[model samples]
Target: MAYTAKDASTTLFRYLNITEQSIKVIENTNKRGFIYNTANGEKCVIFIYPISHKSDNSKNFFDTRDSGAYERGVSWNYALQNKLKYFCFAVHDQVEKYNDYVFSLECQEKIIEKVSGTLNGSRIGAGTQVVIPNDYIPNKQFERIFTKNGFFIAVIHRDNIIDYIDKYDNRPYLIDDSLIELDELETNDEDSSQSVALDDEYLSKLSRNRILFGAPGTGKSYKLNEDREKCFADGNYERVTFHPNYSYAQFVGTYKPKPKFRTDGTEYVSYEFVPGPFLRTWINAQNSIKSRTNKNYLLIVEEINRANVAAVFGDVFQLLDRKTDGTSEYEIATSEDMREYLIKECGFEADEIATIKIPSNMYIWATMNSADQGVLPMDSAFKRRWNFEYIGINQGSSKIKDSEITLKPYGTVKWNMLRIKINDGLTEAGVNEDKLIGPFFLSDKELKSLSIDEIFKSKLIMYLFEDVLKHRKGKIFKSDFNTFSKIIDAYNEGEEIFDFDVVSFLPDESNEESALGSVAEEPGKYSTENE
Candidate 1:
């Protein structure tokens, strides 16, 4: 059962051993609230607001409505004037209980948006009300209590008034005295709760699950690496590449044989559970939370689609549906072996070891290229959980704009320019976008290779021949040089290799630099070494 606003205040006051100083009412404004103080001299004002009928179990929130509205009226003005702390408790409706539990967050002093209504030429709610921002709520579940008939009681441990709220307030607050002292050396003990409000300016922004996909050499991996450094300042990250044979046991965890040493310095073989990247990342995230570091932990998968993604993720895939806070909306049970390992080696509490979840601070990002073959397909259900961002073929082309590629007889042209021309021709020939050449296809270092002809044939021409135009060779290569060997021979002998005019490959026909007039190396900004 759920308790009403008046009943909640009465019961909460008793639980906290609060001495009520009566409801302070301004007869003219109809402004009213109960003022109370704890034994340790923490003064606070409580405003009772009913839970909105439209609210659901998905989230616990409330609206100030007519209760807090005042002409030129505003939030916390009374508490501010009295120099008292402020708290608002939102009680959930009885009909929406789950497992005999009612869910409602215990947050304070948050105003996200305004409810526009007028009363005697004054804005309702004085333009601000107490409400938690969906994104700022912590991953921990809300506080709940049971009620029967009209009696209101708290099932929580008996403690001081401030300690009582800290137990169930899912909304983050500044709790440590050292941190509070660092911000303000002379924090008033009577109004200390005033400092617990969320910082409206500082937002913990992090995307939990994202997949960057595009053609080869599009800088997907490079971009992921760049973001990792910027996001994880403490360098908490684990990187792994997915291949055809990658499995859930290897991705998450599994039992493996281990060698143990006895007192006599003799080694003996034993079997035990071994954690993989997934478990290692989870443990780091849990430790970060326990320490209140508030830092992000990242898990980077180099080629997500290369392996059977659904099979590799297995049941853990369900954790991808993140809430506004970047945490999994649901938790999944872990294998018995995994539970024991997490609790023993990772310092996870026994109560929480049975289940696993992607915490609000743990992020999983991956890169995939749809153009590659021998890779498994991803189902719609699996794909929908990730935010698919396409890394365009020319996404960061400007960075490597100075690199040059040599033409058969037309001198040299910018590597990016030649790539653009080839991409245009390939697209015109009905080739897929994923099969087109990217700016980073040939690194500036590769362009300066002594065996430029061989490098070009193996890197670019072979792709165009073997895969891009496997069915139509003459579409890109010249009709006379139809076979892969013919194109290579013509390219090596300084003959036109493309079906199109050789001059078309050069940006300026006037550039008469010899094939050996290589472009000087430029600082590399993208990864093309393994493209």
Candidate 2:
């Protein structure tokens, strides 16, 4: 049983000892401050906000507010150390007018328990609050704390929670669920600083190729976008979208004609070189080169396979193969050189060509839809040059659940199981290897906006097992198409399946072939190999 919003809300209200009506307006100042209701002898405060913003609102306990004259004399320290059975607050606003204020000293022990319960029942938010430290020292025990709603509020030190509210009114403007802290928060600034501390020698360990793979909807693109921004050294990164027609000229550079109109009303043809995204990223990385540190450039190639990789990428592909001396051997005009070249060679002025680049400090990240036919027949030469990671369809769990924009009822485990089951069913029917659903099929945008049940069937047919689509509809025909259709149709025709719980499928490492191909239940796996 995992924690839920309702459970958190109920526990918080219980801690406050208040009815639903007692909560005034829920504040989301993003600052880390605990709203402890000393009204009860319990060392607990009912978080006035509901589950809607609970995760966002409660982060770290940094400092306390200016409870002003109203907060004075209320000893939180006294409540923690001694077996003080009673704690009280003089509220500027009367909370008792709405609800009965029946509190007993016996409730003191229960207050901490209730607060613990609220904290324990939910893990969706940011900060993980452990026991409240008394005599909390800032530099020693506590650094700074933020509210759940992402407000950087206070610095906690022994006996005092100091306020340091900023422009956000202590609110976190942007929340990235995907960038969850895998490890515990570091107290030391040196270890936890945002700056990439590694030098050239350290960069060698990270030089090996990295691949992002999973079925569709697993957030490959989303993660790539995040890394795109982070991978650059000095805010100099480039991104390129690959399509079927992307040419070699696009990746490198090509001479093209542009119309130039003079003030004298005479129009003439001007030849200029245009640099593409990959070229631009490579160029930017070189421009920001710093001494001592090996400068790194990021070139993100989205849908890498849509274009004929070999045809469009040609000599660059050869260049990528030999990671030796990555700078271009030929002396060519850069974007700056292109401007100079056009003015000198073709008689055009400086303010014409957009941007240019040299190949040094360039790194490439190419994304591809594994399910697309155009991308399926990737040449071996192309494949050997880069690391490959498969993004499968069932990989939807993490992206769906962690996002604040959408609250997926289906959790990661559940979603993965569903994908496994679907894949198994499709493989049993002999669907083509390239036809299986990947992340491209399911739409996060669609799922976020529409309910799963509404678009479930169509999504299954259209995106989930798209490989099945061409096989059933086209020639070179193979497999029991109706069998796959029946499984999908049956799932759609059911109220029970909609009520399905993912926990039903326990983790199975043995039958994990469902990740790539579904192992047949027969004597051996069906030989889908065309040979």
Candidate 3:
């Protein structure tokens, strides 16, 4: 049976010889273990079964064949992997019976001191036993040292666990601090307050070739740029926007004819293979990996869904799968023209020029808006190979510092309040949340400098006409205007004529009227807009 926090606390209190009432259980969950608050306000967690290297059956302690044993092993491994401070206990016999166990603080201390050295040794394994000190006795009846066979329990202080979780909360696995080797500190960087830790934790979980998908205005493209800046240097990254005209010839490489001028001013045409963004980025990454530069290369594809992905990738799709060592899973045959170009211009070996492979250090990241129309649909086979992350609409206020704006007649308003009102209006009009405006729609500088009329005319008006109206027809505006052009004409006439305030544009409560002056009850149409 799975043990609860109460069960662990009861067992812990009995073994530690502490009064149960003196401690309060703060949190007890399978992932976090049992956190208990002591009388003095200090917190700690108890591990029901902790595996050690010296104990018998240590090798099979974590074996999945035994469900009960496997669970205990996982819990113990999590604590040790995260470098949490804990106490361990080994029950001698009758593992199922809890009443026979007795709490001894002296015994616990001696065991910890002995096991500390073993943890630093090379042969450490699950269930490994510690060499108890000679002064410690297992029982009064027996003078010789006794080894336990039941199970191990570990106690970890809460502070250490909290810190570890805070730093790596997004990570899929607990970070093993023991395996980390620190590098020498740089002398010139002594005054640097910035953390040297790499921001590749999210990338580690993602496939080498991945895409970010979300509703329009969700900041998908913005996040890709952010990642490029954070994880890669200037020379290490390249970017391209995909469109309906994008093809394999444009994405990869193709033979193109160029005019060659002669001395007599007569022009002659020469055909040469022109390399595209993918091939160029791949070759650069391959060179970096071969030279052991330890640098990453990233290729960012914006509006990836706008083009036919399968057609653009062609035979190169096979190169996306990476081996365990980060090299391409397969080397695909290249076209004769590409082979010639690779050998002559790219400096590839004669034998290697026949095939091409994506380097492991090369990463391909794309962004797609779920609301886009006219995009070529990707099949399951192609999408399953790439990891996808969804960027949701910003639920909080804009990150812009000291953001506040004042409308001539509406008085001063916070940017967050404006966003809330706009979003509320959009929602009331039956517009999907994904199509709602995002925080980055207007920048900090624009909000501070531009007048309210200019801001509304430039940003919100354009959004309504080009985006909301184009998709939802005449549903979002007041009933007086039947078309987007009519609304624009009305707005141009005078600011006072039409209330640009978000609340005024909301659907009428009594009739659920459309902006076109019709009693429309249908939900607003949805559409994707390129960022």
Candidate 4:
């Protein structure tokens, strides 16, 4: 048996010693535990109070007003309701006798016996005991006679409310205050949950060696730039755009002449050394990690294949290799050496000799456009250093309310699968590999704002698919003007649009018998019959 708001009046009469001519479970539109004047729909919430102040240590019951009922303060009553339905209860301390005499009555004990059987039991670490059940059924299990004022609370599962009570009680345990606080605060203010907390574990899990590879015009650069700003704002990232003109000196460091005056009143100059962005970023990441043990840093190398990988990386690449991957390090000559040595080895100016070493904290992220005519494939050695993720123009990828979109895969995973489908479809049509867009190019924020028709009118879809189609064997996809139109039509009227079956993942609904026929009618789809 499971306890519900319907049992509220009977339970209160038997346990709390409150008597009223009539009582009704009031369900409200708000998401909080509110007392109102109606009961209908699953959207309503019901609030439960301690049965009797004398039976539990919780002081709420003892604070009854002149009307002889427990009085919830202003905050509890006036707070905005914005959370899922929840049941609240307070337990009494056995040692306190202030109100115990009333609960000792035989009639009260009989009610306790009936409800105790459905309670769940658990030991919370110390000698403390807790009992939660689907329904308060006497003789089945022990009931929670006491509540730990502010220390212990349970968020019961709607369905498992019975099993939880039978198994967990009088067990030692620790409770999570933050979890409960988040729920209560949402109920208090009706605010949606924001970004997950920025903690050490999350930072440590960041993809340090990511490569955002995509076709041209798919918005890879935009997303990369956005993430770069976020990482930099946290003071843990450095950005450098790569090009054919970029040299080792520009990336690492170089020595130059500075004007000076000679002792003999003759004009003279002296050589001075200067550091570049790469070295600066390496040093900064190391210093940041030293101060904040769990922090991570990012270095964005735009158009990574534009420059010679070996010439640019020189010696630092090996030291930056992921430790988990077991790659070997390389030894190389430094920018600084005796002028004579530099002259003999690489024919550099004598003033350029000085030593600089790469730090270990630096991690590299790069972007490569697969569709650029001038772009050359990265060398095998350089390619092994990065982890590539393809970005594509996808509506789901750029939608903000993707989780609520009601798809088979639900959220981001839906976008990933769709990207795979596009690639597979294009492959079947004999499209070349070069034209495939990387899925990561688009963000969720960009998708939901535009309708399918609006997106198609922009010809962005044709621009995206054309590159891959050009490399294919047939002229069937060659007409850019028509290709865009067909692509748009498919997106708008496709039958498989809702292929990701999300409803199947939903939990069983309560009251299975009433919904049995409807659930059985669609065994493969959303079913409530077994609830």
| Candidate RMSDs in order | 21.4, 20.7, 23.5, 25.5
lDDT of 2 by residue, 371-395 (tens): 5556635776567656665544444
Single out the weakest 10-residue window by summed lDDT for candidate 4.
Answer: 102-111
Model 4 TM-score, all chains together:
0.38
lDDT of 1 by residue, 1-531 (tens): 344555544545555555445445432232335555534556565554444443443433344434444411232445544555555544432433321222232222211112223222233233323333322222222222211110111212223234544332222222343432112223222222322332323324334677887778877788788767555532356788999999999999888776656657799987877667787677767766865645467889999999999899999989988887778988999888888776554435678867878888788989998889888999988887877766676767767767766656446667766676677678788998787776677766788777666688898888889878987777777878768888888777888777676555445524422321232223232223112
Cα lDDT computed for each candidate against the true fold: 0.58, 0.39, 0.51, 0.39
Q: How would you order the candidates by TM-score, starting with the best?
A: 1, 3, 2, 4
Estimate the TM-score for candidate 3: 0.54
lDDT of 2: 0.39
- Using lDDT as the yardstick, the better of models 1 and 4 is 1
Model 4, residue 375: distance off in Å is 1.7
* Clash numbers, per candidate: 2, 40, 15, 66
Residue 496 in model 3: lDDT: 33
Indicate the worst ten consecutive residues by lDDT in candidate 1: 146-155
What tens digits encode model 4's per-residue C-alpha lDDT throughout 1-531? 322223443443344333434333332311213432223333322344333422233323311111111112111222222322222333332323322211111111111211221101111112211222212222211212222111123433223233332332211121223323212311111111111223435434445566776555455566666655444333345567877777877777666565555546687866644445575465444333333432345678888877776778766666445555222243334543333323332223334334333344566767777566555566666666566665543422333212222222233234334444455456576665556544443345434444423543353345544544555423333343344555455455532222233234232334222322221221112211111
Query: Model 1 Cα displacement at 356 (Å)?
Result: 1.9
lDDT for each residue of candidate 3 in 1-531, tens digit (9 for 90 to 100): 433334544554554555555543222223223444434444444434322112332231211112223222333334444433333232322232223332111122212212221221111223333322322322221111222211121112222222322232111122234421222212122112122333667556555776877656556777678677666654456688999889999899787776655657799987767777798777666655543444577889998889989999999888877787667889898888888766654445668657778877789999887566667888877786677765655521235423667655345555545554566556676877656766566766677775666786668667765766565444555567656567667766643323245435433334222221321112111112211
The top-ranked prediction according to lDDT is 1
Off by over 4 Å in 1: 1-206, 407-410, 448-451, 505-531
